[model samples]
Target: MLNIVEGVRQYAKTDRLAVICGEESISYADVEKYSNILGNYLIDKFNSDIPTVIYGNKDVMILVAMIGSLKSGKAYVPIDTSSPAQRMKDIIETVQPEVIFNLSDKEIMLDSSVSKNVEILDKATLMNLMIEKSNTYDFEISREKWVDNDENSYILFTSGTTGKPKGVQISTYNLDSFSEWISPVLGIDGSEMVVLDQPSYSFDLSVSTLYPGIIFGATLFSIPNSLILDFKKLYAELKKSNIKVWVSTPSFANMCLNDETFSQELLPELETMLFIGEVLPVPVAKELLDRFPRIKIINGYGPTEATVGISQVSINREHINANKSLPVGIPMPNSVIKIVNDEMEEVPKGEKGEIVIVGPSVSKGYYKNPEITNKSFYVEGESIFKEKSPVSALDEKLRLRAYKTGDLGSIDDDGNIRFFGRKDFQIKLNGYRIEIEDIENNLRKINEISSAVVLPINKNGEVSHLKAIVVLKKGINESKLKKTVEIKRELSKLIPKYMIPRSFDFIDEMPLNTNGKIDRKKLYADIVEEA
Candidate 1:
């Protein structure tokens, strides 16, 4: 179970730098040394399965804390300190962690009844402890003494836009499967100076930023949260390093492409631009490909349950047309993808339905909620006089658990999956059924537009209207654009009449969530209050 960390310790004997944060860089030997000290401290402080929370920005201390907690046979819950205070409080209360690890000394008031005994340790104290015990402890956890694969390694909470956030428990097996498949898929070797810009406590992307770097002896670059939105500063800082891979959300990719100077200078060195989390818009895809022809732009897809991404597709000029979206391509080797309807029946080729993923990379279940855990996650037909599944049986086709991704999709005859909007997000209006994304896609497909978002308006038990917010290309004017109402006429040919937005509001920019997702709720509020 802890073989991942053990591998790092073994690989540390060579002359290599393991982690590279802002001003400080640590060698592989130092990583092993620091992690040993921290792991020992954690083992001494808490008994097995005691909950813990790691706070603050991505740094060596955060990495050590994660590894240390896992080494002590406990699941570490990651709380993004940047999240709303109310949300953070709710998570801390629910988890009831024994310790709160913070690098920035961020304080949170806890309820006395359940969480009064929580211990707080800032980054300075951790670093001082590491220095004080420098390379002193000889830690040993042999392969013979392996912890069970079922033991949870980390609990990552998803943003609960639909309900209160639930912690998704990912085990050592999930990490191993992901690292095995994804590392080779990206052609990750040890030499690349990959930037760890994504928050460390986030899903598999955080794992992607860390594990592969350690496995290959590559230098991991850490970016502070404060610097993510400062595009100029970020690009300038990135230019200083010979970074080969740039991993981030599509919005960040769009931002970099929009900056003319960054496109001309900094992007040349970036060999792989990996976009995950949201739909990889065609406009941004085209711009990235046009500017950096040599760079491989991979559009990968998966929910948190799939351990980062289970499928990947690389975008090229010939494959994409003006009218179509790039398919998310094929499943990664060892992953089985099925597009099924409500009846759990498979959909035919080219027909869209819910995407259900079954693979070794899938997580166990939600933490401490058996009702959800049982309903959503289960080993089918296994309870009928069955034996335990062997590690070698990962590829064996038996009745195993599958994650019902609420995401809607269809696999073409060629096995490429095309993503539609979410099953919940789709709407029907008047006499016509519609996908809001279809309308938004048509609006942005026009050469005159740069960005577009579609929202459905409901009033008293009826989906009565469709609203669109758009940003025009640099030279287009709203007055002249008003003459393009016929544009909707063209859009109606592609989408249903009800799907064509009745009203169009031009804007300078589309508002985005902190995670770089389109904040449709915010857009709706702005349109209602102002328009």
Candidate 2:
């Protein structure tokens, strides 16, 4: 963590570029200067230790706010602008922030719904921090409160299977563990390398790029949501980006691979591509190898509970020939990836079991939600199962923490770990981790809906999209298309746009199995048969 702060300082001294978003760019000096100014502003109004919600998409200003909040000893909670107002309200309720930074130029009206005495640093106000007293802020005072060690650096809210959002609290130690380990692994050597920043700050995937890029003094070429929505602009950005390191999900890479222009010729300087947040299909790996033979392709795996990632595998011709599916690879030196049974006993190398990650990188746990945190996370000696069968006794961080990822996996005798998806109703579609039950829970809340079952429509070994099996109330009179539109519009009020099903099947009644529960298998079969 100290290295991270020093890295920023060194880069600022060098006057190198830190972030680039389309036409806008923020240099290291400005990022440091503005963040210090903003940090000083934050220290005046609120407790330095509380989390502050930062609302925006992919703008350079977002980075300044993040660094500033960290400098002021407050963890920044990122909420994307595309997020539903209800979702935003849920986060505000969870974090109970005293201040919210509206980094974008637009206004976010939370006037009527939320009742709180929250201070908002709107765009103009934030700009004023840079304008009014940019040269006279107490940089040393903000630096004195820099977030470190066990203190939460950032709180990322992700989809909860219980229908609420879970804020995973990654501490400065956790971020430091991740960034330090991945830098050398990715072969970043403090050079002026350009890395791609595709994911939003709200998502942990972006942390892999943003933090490491910052700490390593690498230039980040940010692709905002607006440019991503327009292929012409997205490709245009790519053509111009002298990207040496590519970090994005397989879904985003697949989008780029769909166009013939996304090849070595388009990004001649590109050398490393890292993928996570979803399954990396073999076809994508094969195509990338064929197109850019000189580039290195790596697939990483871990949950938000354990920093950005804990394990990684660099793919090659042998891996392509030897395996049907890719492995997430071995654990980092600072962590241990174990396959454990329901009893929490270590499963034999070749046997399938729950993937458990233990290390310093594991998050402090979900913020303010002790019930769920106790269920999913645990300290090493705290668990009877873990105490009975301890993993590596000499391991330094063994006593720190461990996260029980509900993901199924198996490790070979050689220490390579392979993933077999989740043990619950959660799925990743289009690079977004989603809980199907969360959508189902929200759907049942709609007055017109009786019951809903959300299913991932699988295509070519990956989820193509989501389909909802819904049953309306007894006398709701509307066409299927009209009802779908209406239902979607209502959903827009309850959840993020990504969680909404791409297609809907309005059914008179949901199929039932021998048990009283709705038969998801039957509905899935019926849908697949129809297609």
Candidate with the greatest lDDT versus the true structure: 2
Best by TM-score: 2
TM-scores for every predicted model: 0.76, 0.94
lDDT of 1 by residue, 176-262 (tens): 777776676566765645544554454446676576666666677777776667877777677776667767766666666667766
Q: Distance from true position, residue 5, model 1, in Å?
A: 1.1
Candidate 2 lDDT by residue in tens digits, 1-531: 334665677799887899998888999988888887888878776755888899988888888888888888899999998888878888888787888898765676664435467888887788876888766774654355888777898999999877789899988878877888888777677899899988988988998888888998999899888888899888888999999999899888888888998899999999899988888999889999998888999998988889888899899988888868888888887567778999999988899999998787898789998898999888776442343345444234433588999989999777888888777788888778899999999999999899899998888766788999888887457688888899999999989998999999888898888888899999988987998
lDDT of 2 at 420: 85
Residue pairs with backbone atoms closer than 3 Å in model 2 (clashes): none
For residue 377, model 1's alpha carbon misses the true position, in angstroms, by 2.4
Q: State how far residue 490 of model 1 sits from its true place (Å).
A: 42
Q: How much lDDT does each candidate structure score?
A: 0.68, 0.84
